[model samples]
Each structure stands twice: as C-alpha cells, then as structure tokens.
Target: MREYLADISRETEVWTADVPTHMIHFNGDRFLGPHS
Candidate 1:
C-alpha cells in the first residue's frame, strides 16, 4: 500500500508538470468543458 501511494504521488507530480503544456497544446479546457 505504501508503494502504491508513492507511485500515485509520483504520477501526480508528473501530471502537474505536464498538464499545462498539454492544455495549451491540446486546448484542454474545451475537452474539460470549461472551468467554473
């Protein structure tokens, strides 16, 4: 369970770093249906 949690945390970190560039390149707001 601890290892699994660690993996999830690592993935979240990577996603945080990558999401903005992905959103800019792919127009993520359109797919996400607008932030409120």
Candidate 2:
C-alpha cells in the first residue's frame, strides 16, 4: 500500500498521518512538511 501510494503520488495529492495531531501532504508542486 505504501509503494502504491508513492507511485500514484506523481499525479495526485496524497495525504498521510504522521502522528495524532500531524498531517503530511505529498505532491509534485511543492515541498514537504507538517502543514499544521
């Protein structure tokens, strides 16, 4: 599932949870980070 997400991430926006109160947005248009 992880690899699958990474593969399709090239075209769409993917969001994953890093912690109870943190979120990560993966995309090709910008950098990485904990948006909140």
lDDT of each: 0.37, 0.57
Q: Candidate 1 regions off by >4 Å?
A: 1-25, 34-36
Model 1 weakest lDDT span, ten residues long: 9-18
Clashing pairs in 2: none
Error of 2 at 20 (Å): 11
Candidate 2 lDDT at 7 equals: 60
TM-score per prediction, in order, is: 0.21, 0.26
| Pairs of residues at least 3 apart in sequence or in different chains that clash in candidate 1 | none
lDDT of 2: 0.57
At residue 9, candidate 1 shows an lDDT of 37
Q: Residue 15, candidate 2: how far off, in angstroms?
A: 0.6
